[model samples]
Target: MGNQPMIVMSEDSQRTSGDDAQSMNITAGKAVAEAARTTLGPKGMDKMLVGSSGNVVVTNDGVTILQEMEIEHPAANMIVEVAQTQEEEVSDGTTSAVVVGGDLLGQAEDLLDQDVHATSIEQGYRQASEEAKAILEEQAIDVGADDTELLEQIAATAMTGKGAENAKGRLAELVVDAVTSVADDAGVDTDNIKIETVVGGAIEDSELVDGVVVDKDRVSDAMPYFVEDANVAVIDDALEVAETEIDTEVNVTDPDQLEEFLDREQEQLRAMVDDIVDAGADVVFAEDGIDDMAQQFLADAGILAVRRTKSSDAAQIARATGAQVVGNVGDIEADDLGFAGTVSQQSVGGSQQLVVEDVEDASSVTLLLRGGTEHVVDEVERAIGDSLGVVRITLEDGKALPGGGAPETNLALELRDFADSVGGREQLAVEAFADALESIPRTLAENGGLDPIDSLVDLRSQHDAGQSSAGLDAYSGDVIDMETEGVVEPLRVKTQAIDSATEAAVMLLRIDDVIAAGDLKGGQIDGDDGGDDGGPPAGAGGPGGMGGMGGMGGGMGGMM
Candidate 1:
C-alpha cells in the first residue's frame, strides 16, 4: 500500500482499465473547461493568455484558449478531444463542445454519489453523445444543391466589413468568372493562375489581364530579338560602377579632359553590355536613364534594355527571371524561372505586357475582393475563410446522411422504443441516450431564451409538412438561441461534463493500493495513502490541484 514511485505515467505507458482511470479524469476535464469559461459569446471578452516565456495569444475563441493552456494532466487532455471532435462535427461550435463536456462531467459526479459504476457511466455517456450527434446532423440546414445562393453568400459575406461593397462584389464576380473560365478551358491549368495586385495604381487602374504586367519598356533598343526563352533582369542600383575604390578630387581642365572622363564611362558601359550578352538575358530593366554610349553598347550586344523602368517593375522582373544583375555582373541560371510560363505584354492601362510563351502546363487563380479599403477587405476575407473552414470540416467528417431527423433520429427513437421492449440497465441507458440527444435542441432553445422552442418546433413541423431547409430558423429570440437557425450544435457541453465527472468519481472509489503516483499521469487516485514512515496518511485524496488546466474555445464569431 506504499513505496511506489511518484513518476507520472505517460498515456502510452499506462494501460489502466477504463473504470480505473475515471477518478483523475473528472478534475482534468473541469480544469480544461476553466481555461475557456471567459470567452463564450459575441459579448465574450478575449483572454490574453501569456505563456511562461511571454508569448501572447489574444482571442475570444474557445478552441484557441484551450489549445493555448499548457496542460499536463491526462484527464484534462480528454476535454481537448471533445472540443476537437465537436469542431470537426460543426465548424464553429468548439465552445459548445467544451462547455457541454464539462457540464456532463458535473452531472456524472452526482450519479457517482448514487453508486453508478465507471463502466456504466462511460457506456451511457458515449451512447448519449453519439445519439445526440446523429440527431443534430439530421436537423442541419441544407443549402440547395443546384443553387448559386451559397456561392453568392460566400462572396457577399467575404466583403461585408470590407470597403467599396459594390466594387468588391464586382471584383468577386470577375474572380469567380475567371476561375470558372479557366476550369472550362482544356489547355489551362486551374491551379496555375495568380492575381498580383499593385496598390500604387488607381481604382480604375485595377483591371485584370491574361498575362503578367511589368511597368517597364525594353531595357535598350538592342535587347534580344523576340526572345523565345526570356531572361529578365532588375537592377535596383545604377548599373554603372563607382568611379574608383579610392575617393579623389578630379580636376578637369577643358573639353578634352571631359572627353577623357566620358571615354572611361563608355568602357564601363561596354563591360555591362558584354555581361548581359554573355548571360543570355533577353531583357534588362534599369531604374535610371541609360547614357547614349551605354545604350549603343547594349545595342551591339543584341540585348533589349528598358531604361527608367519603375523600380517595382524591375523587382517583379528580377523575381520572374533567374538572372541577377545588380551593381555589377552576376551569373544567371536556368533555375531562375519562378513561373513555368510568362505572358507577353498587352498594354492594359499603361502597364507593359510580360510576354511568356511555352510552358509545360497552365495555371488558374481567382481573387475575391470585398472592398478597396484595407479594413473592409480584411473582414470579407475573414468571413470567406470561415465558410471555407466549415466546408473543409464537413467534407472531412460529416458526410451527407439521409434527410431530416428521418433515419438516425427515428433509430434513436426506436432504441428508446426497444428499451421499452427489452428491459435492462443498458436498455434503459440506451433509451436515455436517445432522449439526451433530443435535449440539444431544448438547451439551444433555453440559451436563446426565446420562442426558439416554438420556432424549432415549427421548423420540425415544417419538415413534416414538406418544407425544405427546415433546420434553419428565423430569429427565434436571444442571439445565442438563434443558433437553432443553422448552427447545428452537438450535445450540450454540460451533459458531457456530468458524465465524465461521474465516471471519474466512481473509479476513484474503487482504489485501494497506495502505489507511487505513477499511474496518476493518465488517471489516478490515492489507493491507500500511507503517511510518512509506513503509517497511513490522514487524508486520502492525496495532494490536490495536480490536474492539468489548459483550455481553448475553437474560434467564435466566424461568419458564413
Candidate 2:
C-alpha cells in the first residue's frame, strides 16, 4: 500500500505541468508570431494559404492569414485572437499586433529562463503597455477631417505593402473621398462605404461612385437603360401576388372563374408597380423578387427596375438616395422615394451592373475597383478595405501617428526609460517588453532586405536623440522621419495593437499547466480501454486538445 500509486483521474487523460507546460506554450506563441513576421512593413511579403479544400488565398493581411490557418494549439489561438481584435477595432495593423504579441512572449521566455517569476513579467508588461499607450498619445499628430492630403497619405500608407501599391495614390484619393462623403456628425460608419470589385481591367481604372452600385442588372432589357434626375423607390416586399399562409386548394370548374382568378393576380401585381409610378419613382430597387408581370408594367412605365437586390445593397441605396425602405409597396408616397442624379445600367468588366450615382449629399457610396484578374481584384479589394478602415479611424478619432515602425521604435525607447521608474524584478519585465517592440522595426528592415542590427541601431540612436518620429525606411533601410515621408497611420491602430498584444502576452505567460481529457472511442489516448480508431497518439495533441505538450512544436510548425 505504501508503494502503490494513486490514480484519481481517467486513464485516458494527459497532463503537462511546471516548466514543460510553460515552454511548450511560449514556443507555440513564438511560432505563430514568426509565421507573420515576414509579412510586416511596406516591403513585407505575402502569404499564400492553401486550405484542406484546396482553396488558395494570397494576402499579407495579418488577420486573414491567421484566420485561414488551421491552428490546433489553444495558446496559439489566443495569439490569433490578438490579430482578430485589432482588425475588428481598427481595421488595420493586424500584422503589427500579432508580431508584437509573439515577440513579447519570446522576450518573456528569455526572462523565464533567467529564473524570473511569470507574475513579475506579467506585471511589468502591463506597466509597459500602459506607458507605451501614453507615449503614443504624446507623439500622435492631430488630423482633421478636412485634411484631405494628409488623409490620402494615411490611406496610401495602409495600401503600400498590399496589391494596390502601384495605383495607391489614385486609390487613396478615392478612399478618402468615399469615407469623407459618408461621414456624418455621429461619426463615420464604414458600412455606408461599399466596395465593389470588377475583374478584367487595370487597377487604375477603379473609380468612386457618388452613390450605391448594385451587382444586379435591370429586370428587363425593355426597361429604360438610363434615367436622369431619378427618383428611387426601395421596397422589401415581393412584387408578386400574395399567397395564403396556410395551404389550400382553389376549386375552379367554370372557365369564367379561372379567368377571374388570373385577372385578379395580374391586378395585384399591377397595383404594386403602380405604387412606384404614382410615387414618381424612376427607379425601383426591390429586396424580394419582382414578378414577370410586374416587370412588364414597370418597363412600360419607363422605370428602371432591379429585382432580388441584396438587402445590404438595398439599404445602401436607400441611404444614398435619402429614401425610406417600405415593406409594402402600396404604402409608398412621394416623400418615401429617394432622389438620384442618374440611374443607369452599365457594362463593367463585361457584366451588367446597376449604378446609382450623383446623389446630392449621399450618405452611402461605392468604390468600383477594377483589376486584371479575379485574384488581383480580390487582393485590391482587401487593400482598399484596409485603407478605408484606417481613414475612417483617423476621421473619427481625429488622431494619427507616423508609420514605418516609427511609433514602435519610439515606444521602445520611451518604455525603457519608464522601466527605470518601475523598480524591482518587474522592471526587467518592462525592459523586456520594450525590447520586444523593437522587433517591429527589425522585421521591417529585414523584410526590406536590409541589415536588421544596423537599422535598429540607427532607429534607437534617432529616438534617443529626441527624434521620436525616426523609423526605418524600408526602401533605403535608412532611419528617417516617417512623418516627413508621408507614412502615417491612425493613432488607434498603434494603441490598439499594443493593448491587444500585451493582454494576449500576459494571459499566455500566466499559464503553467495543461490537462487534456481523451476519448476512448476516438483513441486520443494510449490505454487498454481505447478503441483501434485512427487518431493522433495521446502525445500528439490532436486537434483542439493539448495532448502532453508533445504535439506543441508540431502544431506551431504546421502554421509555418
Quick one: best lDDT, which candidate? Answer: 2
lDDT per residue, candidate 1, 1-560, as tens digits?
Answer: 39987866653343433433444455456555555644443223456656546555555456655666644455566677666655444434455456555655555655565666645655665555454455545654443323233333333322322232335445544544443444432432323333444333333334444433444456544555355455565555455645567888889989999999888877887776676666655556667667677777777766566677676544444433433447544443333323324434444334454444343323333232323454334434333333333333332332332222222234345456555644344444555444433333434444334454574565445544554333322223322222222233122223333344334433443442223344333212211122243432222122432322322221211110
Worst 10 residues of 1 by lDDT: 551-560
Q: What is the lDDT for 18 in model 2? A: 79
lDDT of 2: 0.84
Model 2 earns a TM-score of: 0.90
Following a full C-alpha superposition, what root-mean-square deviation does model 2 have from the true structure?
4.6
Kindly list the per-residue Cα lDDT of model 2 for residues 1-560, writing each as its tens digit. 79999998788887778777787677767767877888898889987766546677888888887777655567777998999899888889999999999999989989999999999999999989988888888879999988999999999999999899999999999999998988888888888898898988899999987778889899898999999999899999899888899999999999999999999999999988888898899999999888999999999999999888899898888888889999999899999988889999888878988989888746778899999988789999999989999998999888999988888888888788898899899999999998999889999988999999988888888988989888788997788888998999999998999999999999988987877776312212221122344643323343334522121222222334
Error of 2 at 537 (Å): 16
Q: Best-fitting candidate, measured by TM-score?
A: 2
